[model samples]
Target: MLYHIRCKKGDKTVRTIKEVVGHHFVQGQPGLLMAHCQNDERVFINFDHFDFLDFSNGWAKGEAIVAQKAAEAKKNEPPQPPPEPVINGPGGAS
Candidate 1:
């Protein structure tokens, strides 16, 4: 889901942040937003610059917020251990 963050605050045009992610506002950081952008870039943008945020899939605010929470929760989880390697022996193809 690509999101368009428009900076329509002032009279002049500002850089529009676009990516395959819903707009995620950073916790504990007022006016700060995080976006997963093109080329697999994770960017921290100033929300103060942008006037609006919209998901390409037409996600409502609540849905996007829920998605953001889920994403953040996943990120907070500890990394899992790699699967044990398989050993080839006379019993083969185990």
Candidate 2:
């Protein structure tokens, strides 16, 4: 089961989890939801600040979201300049 977690205020999708297991902790009473991502990464999300989307039906939507995020990241990044030419010793010979 795939799941998408996002920030509620900005609606920005934080990460995509392929297999998810939700855990509830009542010790400190922070109301945190813990999920295990596809890469076996444990992610903690506060119910107050995040929203979850279940993509069990299909991965098309999830893929779309990922694509959108990639596009956004590419757009926001600055272009890189070419590296300077290396100078050799003596008469410019290697």
Candidate 3:
């Protein structure tokens, strides 16, 4: 069956994060599945066995660390050499 994900009412909704928590079960499942939704209203995948706080904190820190590494890499990269002239007058050097 098809389902309707959440919809937004106003422009302000686009700028924020929204979360929905629910329990799901299948016909022969041993236990109900826990579900979550993000602002886009897309269903979030399970965390395996992580608690909510642990997941959130870990995600935030991971993102920060990744960004920091990227920034550091950019800062430490070697500068590019200037392009050589198309024509050289006499000397071997261009």
**Each model's total of backbone clashes:** 0, 0, 0
lDDT of each: 0.61, 0.52, 0.35
Q: Compose the digit string of candidate 3's lDDT tens values, residues 13-91.
A: 2222234433232223322223345343444322222222122213332343354456567767999999976666766
What residue pairs are clashing in model 1?
none
The candidates, ranked best first by TM-score, are 1, 2, 3
What's the TM-score of every candidate structure? Answer: 0.44, 0.36, 0.28
Model 3, runs deviating above 4 Å: 1-59, 86-94
Q: Over the full model, what C-alpha lDDT does candidate 3 score relative to the true structure?
A: 0.35
Specify the highest-TM-score model's number: 1
lDDT, candidate 3, residue 87?
68
Rank candidates by lDDT, best first. Answer: 1, 2, 3
Of 1 and 3, the candidate ahead on lDDT is: 1
Report the C-alpha lDDT of model 2 over 1-94, residue by residue, as the tens digit: 5555443434666655546543333234344446667677887655544444434544333353454456567767899999887879867746
Window of ten residues with lowest summed lDDT in model 2: 21-30
* Model 3 TM-score, 2 decimals: 0.28
